[model samples]
Target: MKKTKLALALTSAVFASSAMATNGTNMIGIGAQSMAMGGTGVAAYFGAENLLANPALIGKSQGTELIFGGTIFAPDVSSEHNLGEPASPGEPVGKDSSDANLFVVPSAAFNSRINENMVYGIGMFGTSGMGVDYQDNGQMFRAQSALQILRFAPALAFHNETAGIGFSPIIQYGALDIHYDGSETQYGTFGLEDAGHGMAQGLGFGYSIGGYYDAAPGLTLAASYTSGIEMEYKGQLSSASQPFAEFGMIPEAFDDKLEQPAEMKVGASFDMGSLTFTADARKIMWSEAKGYKDFGWQDQDVFSIGAKYSTKSYWLAAGYNTGDNPIKEQDGTTTEGATINFFNNTFFPATTESHITVGGGMAISKKATIEGAFVYAPEVKTRVGVSGIGDDYPIAGAASGDYSETKHSQTAATMMIRYNFD
Candidate 1:
């Protein structure tokens, strides 16, 4: 179709590569209520989203419950190129912005109590993913990319009077595409048209385990663990796309191995009268994962706290969440800096660090409820210093400086509808 439409599709592909449905690259929370509460459902109860959080929560749910909803995500991304101070009067500074800004993600879950001690359920949701599509500015850094992950999980939970445990085998589907201009790269060995541009898709499997225990009156302790998934994408690049293609070996097929990271979370919730408070701590092993580590990512720790006030007809919640930036700063082109490998900083910057969330739920009827939440993460910026090319090197369209930087931010809103079967 149109150029922007094609770019949008490819951008979505890039979004799938990261597990960033909510938190940093992993969704901070699954359902609207959980998101509103700063993704604090780990130790608390959050209806259907528990399948993605703690499978044991399915057994804690009341009668048959179903939730369906989606999020409207919007992100702002920009980049700057720092080419030392102006040697001449009124020299221009380089800057650019991403063209793709809005994306829609969907989610759903169902839980049914088979007996007093058992619960069975199914959930289909988007785990995490994000990307940027920078329009052509200078020839060196123009790139477009994105990735998204969809998960299907069938879960089971068992519970008694004091504790409950649950398990779910996860099936995930992901796709990715990247486009960058390679000809102008200062590091010529980092070929683009050859190894950088193209599309790929893959399937993988993983599992999650979790449980919860009632500690005292109106208080509970909970924990969950998710395993990593390994996937290999079979990709293709066209002969007309970039570098001249050699008709060898399937002509267009290539493979990329991507691994989604594992995570552990612990949390607690206490309720007194009409107010409930929750706190959670989570650790994501990004550096141990395949794709992220390959791109120079570091492990991250996330912390969140939230409070909810409940009345007979409505409930309101607010919270804050923060984590470390996954995108490591680009060191100078020293031997140490050269060891830190990163690709497409302008097109795939994952830099947002903290969020403020607020949300509320309205009861429509005895069987149905609707919830909505808003999340905001302010701007984050980083400067990257590249090796190779230096100043004044563009000898008749040859090469220039390798210094660059980027600034990025995000805003998202989500809505969900829940139905109760009695």
Candidate 2:
């Protein structure tokens, strides 16, 4: 029973917040334009997305605006495990993993001038989480796992020609699911009788603040901060463990809180002739987040640069984004006499480091416009010990203290339609 509980705890430790971008589960940018420009918007014009990117910029909004959009995210992810010496000779020495899938994320926003000095708007978007399906692969950790968070925010802004400020209160809802076949006992004797899986729904609250200033005639500076939200999920678990046993192994009440980390961003935009150039720096405080910190995940730094040129009825944009990996690679030997590194974050691999983006906008008429963007992140691979976040690989049906490696890559395309009012 103790062994069963331990396994359950391991499974519970797999909480990853939102989507996994270079910013560690957060998207590189908030809107189609932002995504196209390497996620930069702090000081640039991005319509209603200012609610999520930088509320203060909304103070500079003109007329009335509405936008709706979605991103088709396709990710390729895989893993591999190395057995130092097969427990049974003639058995396979190393194994490759096939799992993880594609996803679609949606967004919508609207903004209106409340008066000469104020603007109001609301937006809904997601850094939609990721999942893995390793059901067919035997003995691999995590038979299946998936998580995602969606946010809706309403914003108010006050601004003048020289400066502006804005605020947005955020409401968030999310779902989580995890499953692991327990029949293999290389780690413990708990098998199908303990076939473990947990499913739950949760809600949370947060807020964001932003400021923008026209530093000079043609230059603008902007800054924003988003507070973290504390979330507690209530649901059911398949494991007949402590929390699950209290309710007779049915859909009992299992509770856990995953703290979303705060974010800070600052940037500047320059208007030169028909072109606007922008640069932004962002930080994600993963160390302060609940599940991430416990897993030894580190904070991430993101730097972006982009440029856009406007014509009478069309615009073209491109940008680049890069960041550090949050999950640290593990090295050294495990207690079971196996050497490993890099695979430490297999369960929650949110480790894409850079992106290339390109996009454009076309005016369909005096009142409507269409914008589209494409983003690509090259493949990133990491190798680590199979023990998973630890030095001892006690997994059943495999060699003790084996090695595990994972690779992650993605491509995304997004489109948004905006309507304007005089």
Candidate 3:
């Protein structure tokens, strides 16, 4: 019933798209309203913005609702590599690529019911996408920092007592600016300090679709998919000391283009009187995504499950997920970077890991509910750079094309607010 603008942009999602659910499921893993029940809203989605999670679940909405939230990411991305043998002194010593700092995100959404079985909505949010800052004096790592995508999407859903489903015609707007720090010591150009800031490119026009089924009263099944988004940009390539500035001399250089592929998800849920169980499987089509139109984005897949319990006063829940490397590496060197990076995270020797999540919500008053959640991912050991790049800066552990094998973990806290009309 109200005019909307902010939510239209939310369609782009928080990280890349909620389809990944790794970065912030607090918003969509449970949708906004369902989050009030703790973070398990797969089979049961209420409101329009949440439709981005499972359109069919929006069938649970009544009247109109507006939702908005954001996530603050504190990534501890640091690691170490072997200088040679286990007996060698300081073999796996400290490295420069640790923690790129912290990032805070802001987002919003809106929705309304068309009837008991139908609902329509729009949203703006982020997904499980990763961004790294290698600008710390080139340390020889990739100085690649990415852009944030602002989305605009419209969706419609249908629900019945027996089953429900929703579809959203989406248009994601993406803008990423990359800066690479390269062989500053190799070329004489290093005389003029500068990190190459590739001009900003626009990646737009992507879509998503999701659905759910109550196969039975206490059982629900769900799945969703998002299309790939492509970005093309042109700008001067150079790091401090005008290292890459030489390429800029061409003058006729075209914008660098990168493609971000689509993603898919599948989940299931069951309700038993006072407690409910939910689980999900997700896929990221990073394979189609290549940087500099050459390097490729690995295909990533994740699986997660959660349980919820409710009492007369509040509710609680928890979950877990597993991840693999997207960087398809063969020899010690990586084929993904424009010039050749020895320590790129995409293909570096990284370890697989699983995380733990727990959270709960309480009734604030007759018209509102407040919720909070916490997740502590397990420590993952992996390398974090391209082979040649690290050695160029003569960075630690980069010379022999060895990955900086180290530990990494991530966690987040969330709060949700809900109110009903007087």
Best TM-score among the predictions, by candidate number? 2
User: Which digits, one per residue and each the tens of the lDDT, describe model 1 over residues 1-422?
Assistant: 12111112122224322224355577778889888988888888888888988899888887899999998888777765544343354442456677767888899999999999999999999877766664365342455566778899999999998799999999999876665554444433333342354667778999999999999999999999999998765552231122222222122322256688999999999999889999999998888886566455678899999999988778999999998877565454542342231233544566677889999998999889999999888887766665432422222343334555667777888999999998
lDDT of 3: 0.50
Ranking by lDDT: 2, 1, 3
Candidates sorted by TM-score, best first: 2, 1, 3
Per-model TM-score versus the true fold? 0.84, 0.86, 0.74
lDDT of 3 by residue, 1-422 (tens): 21011111110111121112242222224333333233344564434445556666666677676556655555455544442243356554224453344555544666777777787877766543444554553333334555555566678888778677778776666555444433443322333334455546564677777778778878888888877766554442212213222333222322245455676878788889888787767776665653412332356766666777877678877666565645444344432231222333321222334556677768778756666666555556654443433333322443343454545555555555544432
Q: What is the lDDT of candidate 1?
A: 0.70
- Please identify which of the two predictions, 2 or 3, would achieve the higher lDDT against the true structure: 2
Worst 10 residues of 3 by lDDT: 3-12
Root-mean-square deviation per candidate = 6.4, 4.7, 8.6
Worst 10-residue lDDT window, candidate 2:
335-344
Report residue 367 deviation for candidate 1 (angstroms): 1.0
